[model samples]
Target: MVLNELGARINSALQALSKEPVIDDKAVDALLREICGALLESDVNVRLVHNLRQNVKKRVNLDELAASGNKRKVIQLAVFDELCSLVDPGVQPWKPRKGKPNVVMFVGLQGSGKTTSCTKLAAYYKRKGLKVGLVCADTFRAGAFDQLKQNAARAHIPYYGSYAEADPVQIAMDGVAQFKGSKFELIIVDTSGRHKQETELFAEMEQIAAAIKPDNTIFVMDGTIGQAADAQARAFKESVDIGSIIITKMDGHAKGGGAISAVAATGSPIEFIGTGEHVHDLDPFSARPFVSKMLGMGDISGLVETVKDMQLEKNEDMMKNLAKGVFTLKDMRDQLQTILKMGPLNKLMGMVPGMSPEMMQGFDADESTRRLRSYMSVFDSMTEAELNSDGKLFDTESRLRRVARGSGVRPVEIQALLHQHQQFGQIVKKMGGPKGMLGKMNPGMMQQMAKNPGAMNPNMLKQMGGMGGIQNMMKQMGGMGGIQNMMKQMMGGGDGPGGPGGMGNMQDMMAQMMNGMGGMGGLGGLGGMGGMGGGRR
Candidate 1:
């Protein structure tokens, strides 16, 4: 991940404070404000940010901590703890009932993963030794029943539905009846997603939901939808008692933030996430890792738990910030911390489909951290005029010099900070709107990143993580020490027009081949197993 503005902000603030002998309130306030801003940018909810800021401030009283015999080291620990606490770290075990077809209904607008979700859920339960059945009730959309049928067949589950029946409620009722006393113990009802706006269809949907009285209701959603999650979720939430959600197509480039996190603002929790098109990709949802990914942080709860079952409450806090467009320096800094937590810069960014190793190479983590510390110093020295007017620093050379003097960095470094901020601002603008070339810049973003040299900074990564097309697994892997060395051993370093050959066009073919396997772990032992010449993972 490129160190975009958000990461820069957090890194700068954190570094500055890390050097301090005492935890100054002034410094904390600036850092908190920076965090507040970044959280908002990520489209997080407002009240949460307000709560986060207040809580962080309350816990960061250097005088209090110091008086309590808390050392400077502990102060940083307290900071991280306070923030992590806000995110609520923990995992929820899947609590399936003892008996009966734990009736799960997957619902969402058209094209959401409802159809595929039914099959995935069925397969999950089937593996658990429960006989699962499927009922397709989508009469409005053509071929919806067929799709469900095919998926059910693939899952090796019994399915009951009729295109001939007009009443979906009857079909659902019959599905349960047919499964009764049979081998199937769990029955999933697949309903066609009719937008909440469609009165007649929605009415039928409501009737169907009522008739089934499902044990769990899952709303499937596409991941590309960003801050609009609240509105979209609110649209469907009122009609049915939404038990949970399944975020689909996350394997695609779309940011899984909104889809997986509709619960963030809507008060609904996610139950499943579609990892890929294949049968095994449906994953149970908790919240920790998904939220951690959104914040560009590590899975504090542990990787396996996050991958298996997701909810970690603090996710609610993070999502609230992203929805509101408050990308704070602190939030940026936290992401930088995440990078450190995840290892080397290039390897971290390498996991992103669009992020080239070259871009990762361009980032000098030490220099960047040092520059960020210097940047924070400059910001610290800024007068109210400069703080309110980010652009004014450009014309106010003497003032800028004063900032430089106060921060103990050269005047030019302050200028460089200003330049970085400008580039950061442009990238943010692009991210806020069409994102045009800037949006696609990270991996597919390469061509775009080339046009905008500024896109390689901290802010871009934060926003792109929101925009999608990258694997957050890299962020975690990079920070975790062993993973990097492991990945280094795993990385193919040769040339075969693909693999490590660095040929761009062949990457897709390579990606497909890689996807075929469970993961890169299998390749770790092979330094030279493939036909290519570079390093083999």
Candidate 2:
């Protein structure tokens, strides 16, 4: 079974136990059986699955627990703990020291995405205010340096490589020395790979590892390798003390369970997982969240991290402008870009409670991204004065035609963009008036809210807006379960909760923005949108 199917099966097993009239050993055995079957079907090692089942069964003794101790909850926790242990080696992951030049060496077989992974790692750190540099030391693979150079350039990361350099060790030494002199904090060296393990491959890898004295040597494994990942990881670990692992192509792989679990066998914690072909698709691996997602529980921690990583609080001026209901076409453009930078829409959606990566496929995430780009294109075509003004500029047919022509889009499309802007304006108007719903939100609570929306007390939600804020919104939308159903319908291109009559798109967009704002003081920056409608004229 695919990972999603495995998750559903495991969830069903747990739900079955919850529904049992009385907790009993038979029910527990049945639940464990179901879970084992699902894991085995997903290509998880049969022996590992057996161990998980035995461990859970041993811990969940229904008779040993008092009536006060919930048997169902205990069983569930046992399952979660075992699953986490399966992927976690109980080892500390290597960290990059800020002041020093931390050299990270990447190793893997051919087609394991090592070169691309190097760039993705560099890009991840570069966004975190680090001076990241890349070194192309993979001379064994023809055009490896060229590929790294191109990726580094696209990500705007400085890199060192010589087309004439034939010796990998010499190239690695020179590149490290150069980047160290430049005071680059994170220097990633991409090394060569072979199709299969050979003495020569291991020898070269050992040589490079010794020459660079990297802080971390990461083994990049192909997620589709199934149980074979264990052997590959062990082979690499034996050749060089692989400090970490990164499983690649997980988005399309069915044996991700096998790949991830196998890495633990090599005693190395997985640092990241490549979810897609994009450079930003690399996700920092956290065992609890990974197991949580696998069991159909959303990655709440990951969602919060993504929001905090955006550093939305740093835009104090924009937040102030938003509080005054002064949202402009420029502000809208910035938000659109921020949404893009927030990572893949599907990935973000999967972080929501009751949502899964499989279910997110229906969101037409790629289409949503394309739509945002088209809207931004129109914004780009507008004159500075026009962008800074309200929707009045678009009211002039001549101006509409000019922007449409410049953006190479139809006037009707431009009109659609304006309609979206108008919807946002109305939302702001409703929430930012003198007695606006969002006026009472506390700026100090923004960070706390972003960390975990579910933990936000009802009073705090009420302060952000009337009717208990997000809690009320979730209730009216039928809670997370109802939200899933509504999303499925919306994904099918039907009208949303705001009805089919023009308000459907606006309702969806507002819900989206609210969801994104969950941890950002729950609408702290949206306090001043009431003046937006007035600004347009």
Candidate lDDT values, in order:
0.52, 0.71
Q: Write one digit per residue (lDDT tens) for candidate 2, span 423-532.
A: 66665555544554444555455445544443556677667674456444444434545545655554555332232222235334434454336343433322222111
Compose the digit string of candidate 1's lDDT tens values, residues 1-537.
211333344445655766766566776777677776765664545666687777766666666565665444554444454434333323232345746556777788887777887898888787766878888988878898899889888778889999689888898888877886574678888887777678887788788878878777777877656666667788788888776667777655443334433665446656666766767666555443333332334322222221122221223322222223222333333333333333333323333322223223334434533433454555567665556443544586777667767888776555544544444334234332343322332332332232222224445455445323223322322323433343333234432222222221122222211211112121222212211111211
Q: Candidate 2: deviation at residue 510, Å?
A: 6.5
Q: In candidate 1, residue 429 scores what lDDT?
A: 43
Q: Which stretches of candidate 2 lie over 4 Å from their true place?
A: 65-69, 195-197, 325-330, 381-427, 441-486, 494-520, 523-537
Worst 10 residues of 1 by lDDT: 513-522
**Candidate 1 error regions (>4 Å):** 1-22, 67-94, 252-261, 289-480, 495-537
Estimate the TM-score of every prediction: 0.54, 0.84
